[model samples]
Target: MQWSIITIGKPGHPWVKDALDLYWKRLRHYARFDHVVIKEGPLDKVEQQIQAVCGKDPCIVLDERGRSLRSVEMANWIEREEVSGRKRVCLVIGGADGHSPGFRDKAQVCWSLSHLTLQHDIALIVLAEQIYRAYTIMRGEPYHRE
Candidate 1:
């Protein structure tokens, strides 16, 4: 399955970029994956930017208001989604100010990283790493286990 993350805003922090890149490279071995940065703008503009890049496909938006899942549960959820034969799975991350209500309404599923707030850049890195972890767990790799 092809998986991609389309976020609203460029990753400016050098450390966040580096960390995201590191996990992204590691994930490539497991699936077809890509990380895209949408130029920062107004909420509607940014949502439009993400929508344009995402195209028509199944997408799970990442938002604090979304459902929270354990790592194992997330791994299984991804596996199920891929098995369902979806062409693409787009993970959307909002800008620094967070997602607009309209954008949230459009998502097929909304996911939460944590209850605590996270910076947009840091959230990108965290999301990337969690995806990598989920794949590893699905493959029965030692990376994740209950």
Candidate 2:
């Protein structure tokens, strides 16, 4: 299945792009990967932009209030999605104010990286690495050591 990370606003820190590039390259070896940025704006407009881009793919919206999963559990969840015939899946990182009520309600999964709110650029980087980690776990690679 194709994996996409849809985020609101671009990475502000210069090195954040390079940091994500490393994970993106590693992740591409395991699954198709795509990154889409929704221009930052009013909550409703951003929600619309994210929704239009997400289309029919099951979305995992990142929020502080969401469910937390271990790295291995995330891998299993992704595996199930593929076996269940999902063609694409997106992990969405919303803007500073977070997603609208409608967007939050419709998301198939609401994921939390941490209890503390993270800087947007840092959140993107962490999300990318987690995706890569999940893939490695799926393959039983040495990259993920218990």
lDDT against the true structure, per candidate, is: 0.85, 0.87
lDDT of 2: 0.87
Candidates' RMSD to native: 1.2, 1.0
Which pairs, if any, clash in model 2?
A: none
Q: Can you tell me which runs of candidate 2 are displaced by over 4 Å?
A: none
Residue range with the least summed lDDT across 10 consecutive positions in model 1: 8-17
TM-score of each: 0.94, 0.96
Candidate whose lDDT is highest: 2
lDDT of 1 by residue, 50-97 (tens): 888778987788988899999999899989988998778899888887
